[model samples]
Target: MKPGRYIIPKGTYRLTDKLYLTKNTKIIMDKGARLLRDHNAGFFINGRTGDSFTGYDGNGNITIEGGTLDGNLTARYKHYNAIGLARGQNIVIRDVEIIDVRGAHAMDINGCKDVLIEGCKFKGYDINYTVDGDGASYMREAIQIANHTEAGFNSFGSFDAQVCENVTVRDCYFGASANNPAYPAGVGNHGAVADLYMKNIRIYDNIFDGMTYAGVRPYKFENTLIRNNTFINCDYGIRYSNPNGNGTYDAGKAQSGRNTVIQGNNFIRSKIRDIYIVGWVKDGITARVKNIQILDNIFEGVSNAETMYLSFCEDVLIRGNISNITSRFVMGYYSINVSVKDNLVNGITNEVVYVSDATADGSTSYVGLGYTKDYYISGNRVENCGRSAFNMSGLDGVEVHSNVIVNASTETVGTRSAIVATASTRNGHNNKVRGGLWIKSRTFLNEFTVDDYLRKEVKLIVAKYTK
Candidate 1:
């Protein structure tokens, strides 16, 4: 490939081997043009001319626009990575249709930067099972943003563990094809390094429908913005994880990153959760995901499902959202400094705002460790909840005030209230409630106030001085 513009005419061309693209190259395909993969090789390989370039400075300044890149349903998991790129910069891919990827990702952005993928369509993929089998595959993403860590996957450029940063994917459509279903995941990081992290990733104005997994899922990423997207009938709209490197290759490294904002998205009939954030705490090493802001989103048909779920998080804010979830609206576990305010929650099956740690994993260790505290739930209009409007348990220093609740605990059998505070240190004031308020301590014997311990320590010091 030379450093010029190559216009492909309007026809279908068969690709027998990997189409290598060098730097400063632009391949523009006309409408009705198609590059059909005929072999197991990758459709396009960026950088690395005959094993000459092999580092972070492999290639850059490449653009591909228009036409369709058809994988032709090649064999599954044979390392057929279409549009494979590694350690490249200033890459732009626009208005292309990528369909029927075999086993790997349709686009692999491994350790790349300054990349923009816009106005594209990513549909169809092959699973790892036969028709009789379960049709499930482990590696699934239309666009995978990863570091150059795994040699088997990131075999293009240098495996120097570079993070993919400054990337944007917008105005895209990810759905099913004529042959197979949609991609399991839209854009994410499947293989995460220990200390490496992706930053400044923006995904917006996209439509994700019927995905088996999350529409946008990122692991070990920071400074990410996922906004104004439409997700329909997916398992999760957005799933973020900051997993502790406990059992993986880097056992002691904790990949803890922060600062993610998910706003103005529309989630319709998501199967599991609209927004899910999960962190980890293993062997006393914690990967705490913090500073997340979820604001002004619309969620519909969230029946029998969690609208938002957060685990092992801190400094989180969920505000100004409208939802009609018939199940739990917002559930937080083993988290701290969480604030949920100014949201209109309607027709909830359980508590509209529930934060506790009594049974996160059916263990009381998290509660005893005091990892759940400083939760503020206020200024929300909650209506028609089958259970309490605000349920607080196994938490410390929780304040619920200035909230309006109507028609709560309607389907309760007995001994339930619109506001239930059990076995936790709580304070409620200035709340306009239409139903009952029940505040009690379930673990009275084990409930030791902070003042009690401070007074006991003072008495012990006096006794020792007198002795």
Candidate 2:
């Protein structure tokens, strides 16, 4: 209990056990300090207490400030885990108040390096749901940046899978706790070990509310930086993946570790996707997720999902965003060098930028198909589109230019197409749009349409996709 500073004075202690911090420890709690664990035992702050070190080389410069650790686990179900830290280095939890967490993680940060969680407030989360079998606690996470697993029992001493480097979660406040629900991931990492990764993760200015799953999930991470966060109703606000990475097309995998940067976030009303980047290849793998960057974000009110969903990625970048989505704002699949730039969309019920390459038939080995090549849609600014704004298909070096559509063809009765291009393979120039550009020419087994669209202004707005 002593390597230096203590302070703790100002109230209710109650903790039946645990609370073993060591090595240059510094706990300062005054503003009504609280600490209440008081029963159904286990951790309140027991990273296997002190140092008899093993893996990740134990006992770091610990520091916990301003208290309230209350894992009252709401009604019962308490398999434990409130503030468990495994291996460590310069750790510092600030302005704390971690509440009601049950069935794991309110802050389990195993194999840590320079960690710093600031202005904390993580609220209640009691969903054991009889512990989902192999999926373990299913999703659970208030702030678990782990490695050194046992499905994140986090190997307190031995398990050398160590890796949780330079983490930094800032200005926190994840919600939910009038009695459970809301923490299926606020900051994550659920198992992954292929050249052990986790490095330089930095989630900024957080506020995630109602996170039933992913407000920031980055497994096997490396140089991640989800900036300026504020997701509400998350169902996947940022679920960047790397489950052992894609070994080309998933055979003894190992590749996801590159620069990830979802910048300036604000996503609201997201119940499905508000930035979900996955990369688990198939159809003879080889994309394996590369440098991704979705910048200048600000999406609002999109429920059926899709305000950003890039899968099986390669060098990608969707820039300067500002959307008011109704559906698909940027959905690229089986990607390659993708670059949708200068965005400013509004109420698009269909394509505001939908690139594709893999809806099967890439020579048919199936899994998830695969084929997109270099794409570059530029200077976007669509408005009220009910169908096409730029809905490309399988490609080869394509480039849609200077976009600026408005009141796009209300629906598809006479197809007012603002650039549809189905079997993609060409360079579209100066796209300004009052509607006029369809192009369906495939030629693999004959599909031929080759440009046709002339239904001067109709209006319905139903939306299904593909034509």
Off by over 4 Å in 1: 49-56, 74-79, 130-136, 247-249, 413-415, 426-467
Model 2 Cα lDDT, one tens digit per residue, 1-467: 65788897989887777767767788899988887877775444535522345655676788888888777654335667777887778989899887777767788887778989999888877654655333546577788887765555543566666788989999999988776667888898766776667899999999999788788888758889989989998887887777644322224664565788988989898888888777665345453678888899899966367787876688888899898965888787667788988889888777787776655245433222335667787777777777878767666556665555666656774475667666444444333332233433342213222222312331112221221
**Tens digits of lDDT, candidate 1, 1-467:** 77889999999998888777888989999999999888877778776533434445767799999999888873433546788888888999999999888767889888888999999999887766653223325537899987765553445545667888899999999999998799889998755777778889999999999888889988878899999999999998888866567535445776666899999999999998888898888778767898999999999956688899988888999999999965888888888899998999888888787878866567777765677778888778776788877887877766565565556675673356667667564443333332233333453224322234433553454345346
Against the true structure, what is every candidate's RMSD?
9.9, 15.4
Against the reference, the lDDT scores of all candidates come to 0.78, 0.72
Q: Could you tally the backbone clashes for each prediction? A: 1, 3
RMSD of 1: 9.9
